[model samples]
Target: MRADARKNYEHLLTVARKVFTEQGNDASLRDIARRAEVGLGTLYRHFPTREALLEALLRTSFGALAKRADELQASSDSADALITWLQEIIAFTHEHRGVIAPMVSAIEDHESALHASCVTLRSAGAALLARAQADGKARADLDGSELFDLIAALAWLREQPSHASRADRIFGVISGAILARRP
Candidate 1:
């Protein structure tokens, strides 16, 4: 990819992310190209297909999230760090829910890159959870896989316009549960 083409591709990702958030998974690729000041050919050249675009968007977001979990682990109090990371993950899910839905559907049918990314995510989250538990700040019995499932459920709730507040409340409950003192 040449410098200008790379720039155009990055611009398209940014524009597509915003459009997907506002207009959802059904948002038009043509509109995305128009907003990015590119042609349909350029969009297809970069993304190839709508599913490809969605997967790339998901990978970008999930990569940032996994990175953030590492950063939080280094600086914050262990329990606070875990809770904060969970909150950020939930927010990412809400923002990318449109793209995530299809990726999730694909995973349900068979193994794919989406499944690989999910495995990576769970591994990262598990490491953080282990650190927190070892520090005696989080519930010792909490399983990372279970926590991840809860996060996914919460994220799904956040995708709905009417359930945003409900998602927040549920997050609070989960945070409280995980942070409760051990007997």
Candidate 2:
């Protein structure tokens, strides 16, 4: 990319992050272009779709979450690692707002722009869950897909204003159900 084009791309990403943080992932692309002082056509040239823009914005976050999972998996107790990663991922999705839906949708849609990142995030959490289950700290009946679904469900709950206050308590209940009792 040319220097000016790269600058515009980075500036758009920065402005988009602020807009998304304030208005959520569903914030208007036109508004982002306006905020970034770029033409709508320029924005489209850089990110052809809303999901493409989101994919660019969240790529680093997705990788960080995956890396955090690896760090937690190696450094923490099995059950603790799974729960911690769950809490972190829920926080991540909640922080972005409105992203959970697309993420959930992307998990099953191979053609989605967000599919690869969502899959990587899910696989990271799944690995932690697997470690917990292998250590006999988690329920044997659960699988990676179910765990991913649970994360999506929990993250979605956090998005609801009515349920936001109860999210932590609800998370505790769900996590408790996923774990085995100590002897």
All models: lDDT?
A: 0.79, 0.93
lDDT of 1: 0.79
Clashing pairs in 2: none
Native-vs-model 2 lDDT?
0.93
What TM-score would you give candidate 1 relative to the actual structure? 0.76
Task: Give the Å shift of residue 8 in candidate 2.
Answer: 0.6
Weakest 10 consecutive residues of candidate 1 by summed lDDT? 104-113
Tens digits of lDDT, candidate 1, 8-108: 98999999989988898879999999999999999999988787777677886778788888888796688888888888887777666565466455544
Number of the predicted model whose TM-score against the real structure is largest:
2
Query: For model 2, how does the per-residue alpha-carbon lDDT over 13-48 read when each residue is reduced to its tens digit?
Result: 999999999999889999999999999999999999
Off by over 4 Å in 2: none
Residue pairs clashing in model 1 are: none
| TM-score of each candidate structure, all chains considered together | 0.76, 0.97
